[model samples]
Target: MKRFVVRLLINSVALWLTTLIVAGVSVESYDADDTLATVLTYLLVGLIFGVVNAVIGNFIRIVAFPIYLLTLGLIALVVNALLLLLVAWISELIGFGLSVDGFWWGVLGAIVLGLLSWLIGVLLRPIMGRSR
Candidate 1:
């Protein structure tokens, strides 16, 4: 779907920005110096992240709704960080993907990634259309 593709692109851009800004959060591609390879790697990782978040994340959110409310939604940061780590582990199994230094790094990286993705999505919404 168009919306899914747009979201994937936004996630790729967000992940790219996170790697640039967060030293501890880096992505390694098949060819480190190849820009196209790096971009595709990011896109592929982003897709994996999205899928993992959509499935596992939704389940966690539903089960942990009470904690989420008690924390005033701050728990989402932790959840997102865990999701990032999950993605990292999954990517590692396949080789050539994201590498997060630690839990704190994953937390910081997830925060920045979420912000960047939101900002990019907001900016592109007009062009991409409100329905999406």
Candidate 2:
């Protein structure tokens, strides 16, 4: 439970940072004037992303194993980008969350988000009592 919350927070922060660094990827706050609502919006988007990556992302990786091998794992970038786009679509259906401009933007955003998440995880490894 604690670990899950920590990961979710890490993802939320990484997502916020990604939006700042990527112009084409952004999240919409439920209430523009309410800071709490905005934070909740990010958290919700992060949760949705986590769930999508855990479920659909894993399925894609398994089914595309042959393609991944053939492409020397390069296809992972496209897979991750597609997963991000899926998250954006799901959030859109909810009416206020992540909005990705296009596939290229989704790719860039996924790259940024992944790097940020990795860095944060590494930095917090000691506190989390996990080793790489």
Candidate 3:
């Protein structure tokens, strides 16, 4: 449970960073007007993101093993992008103010957002953890 919360917090930071970098985005983000609500929304969205990624991402990586092999693992990046796009779709359905513009955008946005999250996570590792 503690690890899950940490993961959600990391994902929330990633999601928040996504808004800063991506335009024409609609995430499950609340308006900046309400600081508390926005923070809570980030946590909620992060929770959803973490859970979805855990459940679906593992299956996707497994089922697409052939693609991964064929592309020499480049397909893994696409899979990551698709996952973020899926998150965006789910967010829209749930009334989050987040949306991915298109496939290419999704790809780029996911790459950037993912890299940012990874960087932040790495930096936080000293304080939070060294390994999963």
lDDT of 1 by residue, 13-110 (tens): 99999999999999999899999998899999999999998999999999999999999999999999999999999999988999999999999999
Worst 10 residues of 1 by lDDT: 123-132
lDDT of 2 at 89: 96
Q: Model 2 lDDT vs. the true structure? A: 0.95
All candidates' TM-scores?
Answer: 0.96, 0.96, 0.86
Compose the digit string of candidate 3's lDDT tens values, residues 1-132: 666666778888888887788784445446767888788887877776777788999999889889889999998778878887787777778776457888888877778777887987887777676666
- How do the residues 48-103 of candidate 2 rate in per-residue lDDT, one tens digit apiece? 99999999999999999999999999999999999999999999999999999999
Which sections of candidate 1 miss by over 4 Å?
none
Q: Give the Cα error of residue 47 in candidate 1, in Å.
A: 0.4
Better of 1 and 3 by TM-score: 1
TM-score of 2: 0.96
Clashing pairs in 2: none
Q: Provide the lDDT at 120 for model 2.
A: 94
TM-score of 1: 0.96
